[model samples]
Every structure is written in structure tokens, then in C-alpha cells.
Target: MNRIGIPLRVGLVLVSLIWLVPYAWMVVTSVKTLPEIVAAPTAPLPAGLELGAYREVFESMPVARYFWNTTLVALGIAALQIALAVPAGYALAKLEFKGRALAFGLVLATLLVPAQVRFVPVFTLLADVGLTNTLSALILPFGVSALGTFLVRQALLSLPDSILEAARIDGASELRIVYSILPPLLVPTLVSLFLFSFVFHWNDYFWPLVMTTDDSVRTLPLGVALLREQGTGVRWHIVMAGNVLLSAPVLALFALAQKQLLNAVAASTS
Candidate 1:
């Protein structure tokens, strides 16, 4: 068993290294000079460290503006998702209402329907509302997430019914119970929802691309795509540098929240 375990562990380590190699290359390439990057495309370390690519990335585009746009859109979407999803989740999990199950079933059905299938209709509606070229176009459409609603609902369902019954006996309104009693228990779910919304909006590319024609409205992903388009034959190092800058915040956020995210999942299951 020990001999088998040793070889299995070694194989897993090799697979993990292979998976991380591309990301490692991106980091190394970002700091490498153009000539050196071309010379050693897969070098584990920077052949000669240089800040020129990073400088070029900042100089060539409004990277800061792109970052700000993405941040604002992501935050707005997360807030709206939480606002809409939490109450909806609570109602579905606790309240006895007509068509409640039907409504939830419809929401579940929506998960089966790909967003791409509705893209044209959504775009047309936004166009009609005169929000096609604005950040609202990106943020509003994704404000109500089916997955968030489902996750929050499941979390709520797992709570002891006695607590809710006690709240009702004490004459607490549904809204009051939600705010005072249930909300505290839902911190983990809320955090997970926030993280999900943040990442989704941050990394969103297609909807933003379709909605915003102006350079000023572009998010980081769209900005990166535009950079790639314009920077042909200029070496990929500058683009890689821009990618690093764009992704650094997301990576940091995930690293910080990963522990909390895992703990939340474990707590929910327990």
C-alpha cells in the first residue's frame, strides 16, 4: 500500500505541476524582455527581469479605467444579486404561498436555458431601453442569478424550523425575522453569493463586448481582447503584463476568501 501510494502521490504532483505551468509561464513572461520571452517560451524563471512590459501595458491603454469600470460593474451586480436573491430565497424556503413551487421550478428551468440563447432578445430589450452602450446594460441583466437564489434557498432550508416558528409566535413580521433572525445564520451563504457574483461580473466578456461600443465602457476582459487585437507582432509580454494586472485582484480575493468559502460549505453541509 505504501509503495502504491508513493507512485500515486508522485503522479498527482506531476499532474498538478502541469496544470500550474501555464499560469506560472504567464507570470514569468510578464516580467521578461520581449527577446528573452521569444527565446525561452516555457522558461520556469525570467531569463532577465524587466519592467518594460508592465510599463508598456500601462502606457498603451487605459488599464486603470478598465479596472475601475470592472470594479464598479462587479460591485453593482453583486449588490443587486444579494438584494434580490436573499429575499426570494427566504420566501421560497419558508413562506407558504401560491405558486411558490411553480416559481422555483421555473427558476430551475431557467438554469437549463443557456444565456446565449436569450442574448439577442436581451440585447434588443436593452437597445429599446436606450441602455445598450452603458454599464447598466452589463450589470442589470445579471443582477438576478438563478444559481444564487438556489444556493441561498438550500441554505435557508437547512435551518431548523423551530427557530422560524418561535419567531412567528413572538409576532415577528417575515421581513423582521429575515433581518434579525435568519440573516445572521446566512453569512456564509451571502459571502459565497457575493464571491460568485463578483467573479462572474469581473470575468464577463461577451455581454460587455456586445453592449459597449465605446472604449470608455469596456471592462478588463474586453480591454484585454482589444489590446491583443491592436498589439499584434509587438510580442505577447505587454499583453501578459496587462492580464497579470487585471487578474491580480481576483486572485488575491480568491486566496483570501477560499478558507471562508470552504468553511461556509462545510458548515452548511453540517
Candidate 2:
């Protein structure tokens, strides 16, 4: 047991360090002077920290506006996904009705369908409705998350039905039970879902790129890409700085919600 444990611990540590390498490089490069970056592009350490790249990144683009747009879109998507996922998940997991298996199977089937496959039709629909180049276009298309619904359903399945029955017996309506009674029990799962949705949308580049033709409603990823394309050639330091800006919120969110995320993993696995 000791031998196995020791090797496992070492492997985990090594994997963790490997995972951190890109983030470390991003941080290091973001603060490197242009001269230093040009001279030693592969240097693991910066001779001196230069914060000019961040300032240049801000000067080069409307980062604040993009940040605002991303925040609104990401939060909106997460909230909407939770609102849709919870009840659908509950119905699928708890309530037995006609075609429930078929409905659930459809949700599973959606998991196999890539977003790219549906983008053209969705884009056309949004275009017909005159919703193109707007935040609505970004938020509406992602209103239902198949993966989120599946996760919530799986999480609900692990929970006993006695809780739902008890609530119903006490005159709690289904809506009330879902919103109030079960939320506390499902905080971990919901938080996990929220974080996943937020992060996924926050870093989303493809949807926005394909949807919006103007920068006025663009998000941070687009802003970063525009920053990369600024000047005659790519500016590594400024681009890395944009990446740093993009990554900061996610890191902060993980730090704040890590406990719940861990609980979600444990609950899901158990």
C-alpha cells in the first residue's frame, strides 16, 4: 500500500506541475520586456517584471467593454442553463411519465451532436430574426446545455426519492421543492454546473467570432484576438497580457468555489 501510495502521489504532483507550465509561461511572458522577450524568447524567468504589456493591451483595445460583455453573457448563460437544467433534470430523474426515456435519450443524443454541426442553421435563424451582432445572439443559442442537463439528472439520480415525496406530502409544490428544498442539497452540483457554464462561455471565441461582425458587442476572446492582430506582427508580450486578463477571473472563481467543486466531484462519483 505504501509503495503504491508513494508512486501515485509522485505522479499526481508531476501531472499538476505539468498542467501549471503553460500558466506559468503566460505569466512570465506577460511581464517580460519586449527586448528581453525578443532576446530570449524561451527564457523561463524574466529579468525584471514589466507591467507595460497590460497597459498596452488596454490601450490597444476596448478591453473594459469586452470584459463587460463577456461578464454579462457568461453569467446570463449560466443562470439560464441552471434555470432550464434543474427542472428538466428533476423531471427526468424523479417524475415518471410517458416518453420520459425517449426524452432523456434525446438529451443524451444531443451530447453527441457538436455545436459546429448546428451553427449554420442557428446562425440563419438568428439572422432571420435580426438578432445577429448582438449579445442576444451569444446568449440565446446556448440557452439549453445538454451536458448540464445530463449532469444534473445524474446528480439527482444519486439522491433518494424520499426527499421529494416528503416535500410533496408536506404540501410543497413541485416548483417550490425544486427551487427551495433541493437547491441546498444540490449546491455542489449546481455550482459545478454554473462554473462550467460560466468558464465555457467566458472563453468562447468561435460562437462570437462567427456571430458578430462588429467589435461593439464582442467579448474578451475577440478582444484578445484583435490585440494579437494589432500592429504589423504579433506582439507576444501584449497578447500574453491579454491572456492574463482573460485568465484572472477564472482563477479567482476557482479559488472561491473550489470547495463546492470538490464536493460536486465527490457527490457525482459516489
For every model shown, the clashing-pair count is 0, 0
**Model 2: colliding residue pairs:** none
User: Candidate 1's residue-wise lDDT over 64-177, tens digit each?
Assistant: 899999999999999998888888999999889999999999877887877688889999999998998898988998878888888889999988889989889999988887
Residue 102, candidate 1: C-alpha displacement in angstroms:
1.6
lDDT (CA) for every model shown?
0.84, 0.89
- lDDT (tens digit, per residue) of candidate 2 on 49-101: 79999999988888999999999999999999999999999999989999999
Instruction: Report the lDDT of model 2 for residue 224.
Output: 88
Over 4 Å off, model 1: 1-4, 38-45, 169-171, 232-234, 260-270
